[model samples]
Target chain A: MTAAPHPGRTRRTVVLAALLALLAVAMLAGVGLGAVPVGPADIVRAIGRALAGEARVPGDAVIVDIRLPRVVLAALVGACLASAGVLYQALFRNPLADPYILGMSAGAGLGAVIALTLTASATALRFGVVPAGAFLGAVLTIVFVVRLASLRGALDVTSLLLAGVAISYVLSAMTSFVMVFFRESMTSVVFWMMGGLTAASWPYVWMVTPMLLAGIAVPLLSTRELNLMLLGEDRAAELGVDVERFKRVILAAGAVLVAAAVAVSGLIGFVGLMTPHMVRLALGPDHRVLLPASALGGAVVMVLADLVARTVLAPVEIPVGIVTALVGGPFFVWLLVRRNGHR
Target chain B: MSVRLAYEAATVGYPGVEVVSSARLRVAAGEVVGLIGPNGAGKSTLLRAVTGSARISDGEVTLSGRSLAGLTPRERARRVGVVPQQVSATFSFTAREFVLMGRHPHLGRLQQLSAADTSLAEEVMARTDTLRLAEEPVDTLSGGDLQRLALAQALAQEPEVLLLDEATSHLDLNHRMQVLDLVRELADAGMAVLAVFHDLDLAARYSDRLAVVAGGALGEAAPPPAVLTAGMLSEVFRVRAVVGADPVTGAVSVTPVLREEAVPAAGLGSVLVIGGSGTAAALMRRLHLAGYAVSAGALNRGDVDQAVAAALGLEHVALPAFGEVDPRAEAAVARMAATADAVVVADVPFGRANLGNLRALAEVAPRVVFADGFRGERDFSGGEAARLAEGLAAAGALSVPGDIDSVLAALERFTAR
Candidate 1:
């Protein structure tokens, strides 16, 4: 059968285009507004030369080497987290669900702290060891929580959330124990826990791109199922959805997205939780539209947050996570108050 | 007249506990069958079995001779559509979007809804009269509106068999009838419909057949007139009710007997009431409420007093309607009055038909209390009834006003003795 024109198709397209434009502007500002500022023309030339594989200019290293990878990495991590947020919110059928709600951040933090304490050399810590450890820990924690929550092959959302909370507390306490004993690694562990994109590189951007694409693509393909899931699992099942298998697929996808983002960016907060919620408030909750809009909205928020993180403190950089929370916290509250007032 | 849906000895429940056992039923291609029961009698479980939500451990539920256990959820949904009791949506979806989700089972994994599907959704929405709320968010709609939208969504599935699990409980009376009318129209178009209803009257009105679930077993499915009876109402529902045909709709009507308190076992002894043509209905109810074993005599069959007596589960002597009190009925009334602690003669106007009731009261005059209010004009036997009443007064029969409270007070004095 031929595909019908959706009623919200035009509005979704317009919202997506506007978000894409906003993301382009945010990336431009991120690249041009650092301590050693570059002009728009210079930024364009730097990107062009980098794409053409030409010889480097005097200002090319600053734009191409430093700001470009960081901005791109910020955008990827933001999209990954936001898409995860959308999947999770639909999976649990709760608007409050987010990327880190299943204890992924705490698990990653614990793993990163363990790696920092074990490795005597800071160079090894900076290489792939810490991120690999974080990824492994996050996935393991999610699997354990899922196993704990499932009974007779049915995954109970309430039990899953409770297990996540319990496991998060235990892992966080272990991380604190490691930090207290290994005094030399304390500052590094603290910095990682606060989260930053200071370790951004071309390799890191290359690593996250495919996974981020998969994260976004999976939710986009399953938008119909996700919309059905919002009514509830039982209702979704009655509508011919294989609810248990669907939950597993979504939970696995969300776990991978969050774990990948956490491995690269440490424990960034609020981007996942706030971005999807903002998009849903502006655009309605048709996952066909909400998923794509949230991906773009999330990328815009993170790129801007990273821009503030590097520039607001000048030479001494604040963690990007702190910037997001400081900005996202107030904006989220304002949205809630405005929505309540309308109601 | 093929059976589209059938439950052949189905026993449904979750893992060890059986909620419903040995349920056998069938619905033809163009019939509406209603399932009724008290709370937790497994009415919903039977519906769930059809949707494959509950497992049938014993026999099987079949759709058009094929077992439902083997069909995939999409296949089952394509054939059987269910409108559940309620749905709590966590997200804000427009009414149109919500209705479009019903086309999910028909669409393939990657297939978008075609133009045909969209028009079908619109058609169902119009049929359910919810097209005006298409753009409104479902969460913002009232309960009745949401229920109609749910029906629209279910209809959009285009299933051959429709199951409603108390779907109309949230609707107002007008909307309830509107929805049921739409359902009837659908059944007339040859869809098999099964609905669970807590409202007995509605079930009786709309159902061509009804299946009763009680005490974990399924009763026989029969026509509404056969299923809804005073005996069944008292036995299964534990309430006294009068089951009759509605004068307006020609459907079986059930009027529940509302008891203020449980009638004690003749705490004030038995009271025999003599009256006809509704004069003794209130007095019978008041006496029954006061913990007396109340009996009425020589009440014409189909009289208001006879219905009240039957509804109250009181022993009474009934005669043919509009006929003179026969000798057999008068003897029965005399036997009841002889055993009663006191007899009450209600302010019934004397006529040729019920002059026998006054004569029956005269045999036990010493134990009788008359609520006659000294009205000699009510004697239509031309002073023959007035002369008998004066003779009863002379024999020490107590006289009280026609009001119920004064008659009750006079009976209280007799009980004090």
Candidate 2:
């Protein structure tokens, strides 16, 4: 309780400060930068004018209406993906695992594809299509993963990963087959497949932010259990962490986050895989630090990618997925090289 | 602070195979209970069952007359703490964090650490001599250090009853003694401790009561001298041995008698064995099976391996350990070694405190062979065995491989010799 410079508390303080600063910059840049090139002052003015019931800024209204929702949605999706990544990595006690390693994304994608195919004929279901499909897919995948992994008395991570990978590949192949069969709906499906925030609206932001916050907060509270799990399941159980129930809860929570993200913007890769690891390298392997940092770091990466996606061609657009792949691939290459050399 | 633990009609094992059945065990508070058994005796299974990590199958465990079945996890944890057989951490949590986990059962759901709980954890860590490691990662701990850390974690729980299953198996002699001393101190403080031990002498010296489990049944559950007798050991452990009180500590001491296989089928050569305890049993078994006429001496009859040699009807010359050597027994050993094709000395203990046995072996054998003891520590009597081994090696005696398989291979090499 003394305000003395304790090393542990000081380090946590420094890390929290740095993460806040990064998030602030990411938010500002996401609001200000776009093909229309609104400056930070005008962006602020437009937000204030809209709040003050004056709906007139030369091109500022377009930025708020179009780009702001997409940017906000990207941040929500990114935070969800990264925090879900943190949970899965800690739950399995494997550094290489990610949010989608549980098959939630592929299952969600398959469900979305089926919905799209069904909705093409029944045009009345246009608004209900993607989110409904994603939720159903996530719930189904979690059930399958849990059932397959349960052997003897408890669920195991190694078996869960194997089952997840098998189900994911099967679902992916089926999705590809469906895409080929319904070539007439190819453009709309391809847009979802490309992982863009183009369709993001204010209503979507309201839906996702609360879900992402819950995903982040729940896992943060259970950081100690995740730490115990790293000692192996039997040891964890001996130490009073209900190892079986913890696994079920974490898997369910991770699925909900990933399914919710895919519900808005189809599968976005690398954020889930890279952000937790990057945080671990910086903050050390404690889940209390790693989980929140992953959420903030994922938002930063996604927002930056969104800015480039909207502005790189200036009035011409590239899908945000292309920008994420472009940035994340080289970043991942450097990470792998540095990690390999370090070992 | 007295910890009374009881297990009644406890049946434990895998899904179908019951290893321990209907075993009733009771230990009064502040008593150090030792559970000793042979390799497959289900001692560990009973410990796990009591800890509630393993299912009870059909029985009940009670701490202080409270049924363990009815207690919540947190409630049970407050009464009992468990130290498992092996400690491994796949993630590197700082030692402080690791020990703090012991306070889990004491904390309410979603409750952060209270100031009192943190202080209790630190106090326990210091008492366990694990405070030095508080900031260090648990994964980076050495085996001894890790065991102590594990002890700290259990102690931090501040439970009334402590259960350790072979906790000292990975420790060295010094650390093992230190850890056992700590257990005694904890029991003195009025905590109940039920520990499973492998070393018989350590069990006898420290434990208030010893529980010997063998062949899936309780052999003896009494004070040391009564439980660790020669007859009980031979019947349960299948090794013939003498049991007596230690001169220094007044605790039970064991010396194995030689029990070889039957006399050689082809009489390839005569083997003169100068060894004691386990090394002699192994040497007797290997040499006799390899078709050698066996004769052994410089050991007492109550020594378990000597009984083994007697059972195989080997030409044995035994001597009593209490008084001066018998001149006739000495003469028989000399004659046996002189007539033999090879003389094999197993990794037997020889204290400078007792030099007559080594001098007699040295005088009789033209070729002296020795096997390495565990980790080459040379048992409790260190310098004397090494110097004797050095002399034998200089005199062109073969130093057989230290491990069991290698010992058999060395006998095959001797077949050609």
Candidate 3:
């Protein structure tokens, strides 16, 4: 069908393009601004030489092996979490919804600890056992939460959030118990729980990139149904939306996104919560613009946050989750205060 | 006109409980049907059954002779548009965007709204008088404006059948009229409409046929004049109301008979209220509610007192508009005044047509209670009515200041004697 020339479409297109440019700059900075700082031309030459199977430069190993994968992985995880945030917020019609609010992080953390305790060799962990366990745990936890929140085929959003919080507490306690029992793996578990991109690698990036793409694309295509959902379920249904089936599909997609992000980055917080809010504040709540804009905005925030995490203390790397919360928490509070002041 | 929407003996509710049973309704093209009932009488449930939100457990709801059970929600929505009582929006969409969403059922999953759809949204907004609000955020609108926006959205659907569930309840009087008038215009243009109204008078005024829902069953749908009656108001609505044609608009007007439980016992005595031109309406109502058998006389046919007297079902004498009180009306008043235990003369102006009523009150002088109290410039009978009032006062007729309470007190003292 031919598109009508809408007045809002032009502004939305400009905003999306601007966000894409910002995301590219953040990724470039993430790849070049570390301890072994590489310039833009040197970074490009390194990628080109690696693709052509030529000889390595002095910083080629640092660019290709470390910073490139780390930046790519951060972008994928950020997009996944932020897109999942948009989906959950629309599904619940609640402003406070986030990617990890449904106990997915706690469940994934528990699963990773169990896998860490079970595996005796580091090679097994390198071969994708821990990420697999984390992905499975996150998906199962979301399914359990969804089932618990449904009553007679209708999903109650309030009960869903309440059950998620309760399940998160229980799963975290179980993870702590396992950590205390397996003292040798306690440091690894604690570091993972704080959430970092330190395990970023080529295999990890390849595995999660497809899931993140799918997570963003499905919701982007279903923006009409997502918009209808903001009008409330009954009204949306009356207006021809299959609300129950749509909810199931959206919840499943959100589960995949959060599971994929948590599997690689271990429990990154606030990117999911703050990215959508920022994009929505700048643009509007129309999911057609919101989903893609938030995905890009999230990538920018994550890449920059990850950069600060590794370089701010020289050799000592703070968790990326700590940086996001420290930066995002105050920014979100300021946005809220400013919004309330306008009203 | 063909029936565009029909509920064929439908029993609708959720699982294991029936909210409305054995309901049969037909809304044909080019007509508006009003559904009215008390709270919890399942009026809204029946409307929901048409949209498949509430299930029709036993029978079927059909759209244009096709069973609604076989239709997809999109197909049903393409044919029917519903404006609910209220909608609480969670996000901030412009009013134009909200209206454009009503075109959703006609578009494909990934299709954008065409230019025609945008213009149609504008058209509907204009019809609902909400064009100025097109750029305003929907969450910032008042309740009435939101309700109108909801109507505009439903109209943007361009459905063959429209359903409104108390959609105008939040609107003020002018907006209510404007909305319903537009609904009437749409019905005239061949759109079938089924509206649920809490305002009985508005329903009686706008509906081509009114269907009553009471005691879990749907009553027969008929014209407003046939459906809105005293018996139906008492039986179905639990109200003692006087249902009559409005004196000016010729529409059905309902005046409730509010009798307090602490009112004195009936058959107290007979009271003949001799007045006209609306001077005796309040006194007549007070005496009637105070257990007196009240009658009025010689009122012009189109006068306010005549309408009030007819609505209260009082025994009275009537005259033609601007006509003198003839011999038959005068004789009827004389007979009523002779039998009445007390005669009440209201503070009506002394015009030539009603001068005979004052003469009749003079004949029943002992039981006369003159409530005129010479308050205003009431004399217009060439000083004859003034002389009659003085003679009546000299003949031991009680004089009360022109208010119902004092008249009732004088009547009570006369009854005690």
True lDDT of residue B165, candidate 1? 91
Model 1 lDDT tens row, B135-228? 7889889888988888888898899999999999999988999999999999999999999999999999999999899999999989999999
Ranking by DockQ: 1, 3, 2
Candidate 3 DockQ vs. native: 0.39
List, residue by residue over B1-417, the lDDT tens digit for candidate 2: 343898777777767777877778887778889999888798888877765566777787887988878876668777778787788865667888788888877776677666777777788788777788888888788877788788888887888888898888888888788878988999988889888888888889989889888766765478888888767776677765557668799888876553323334587777687776646876776677667788786666567666667655577766665433466666667677778766776777665432444555665334565666323465456666567656656666666666656665655555565
Among the numbered candidates, top DockQ falls to: 1
Q: Write the per-residue lDDT of candidate 3 for residues B336-356, one digit (tens) a residue.
A: 999899888888898677788
Number of the candidate with higher lDDT, 2 or 3: 3
A1-343, model 2: which lDDT tens digit per residue?
Answer: 2323233556776787898798778877888776556677877888888889885857865777877888878888988888888887777776656756677788888888888788888765744676678767877976877688875457666687788778888887888899999999888777887788888888788777766766566677888777777777766766677767888778767776886788778767667878888888777787767777788888888888888887888787777878876766677668658757955
TM-score of chain B of each: 0.90, 0.68, 0.86
Off by over 4 Å in 1: A1-5, A111-167, A178-186, A329-343, B258-261, B277-282, B346-350, B366-407
**lDDT (C-alpha) at residue A58 in model 3:** 85
Mind listing the fnat for each candidate? 0.66, 0.40, 0.60
Please provide TM-scores computed only on chain A for all of the candidate models, following their numbering: 0.86, 0.85, 0.88
Question: Per-prediction TM-score, please?
Answer: 0.91, 0.78, 0.87
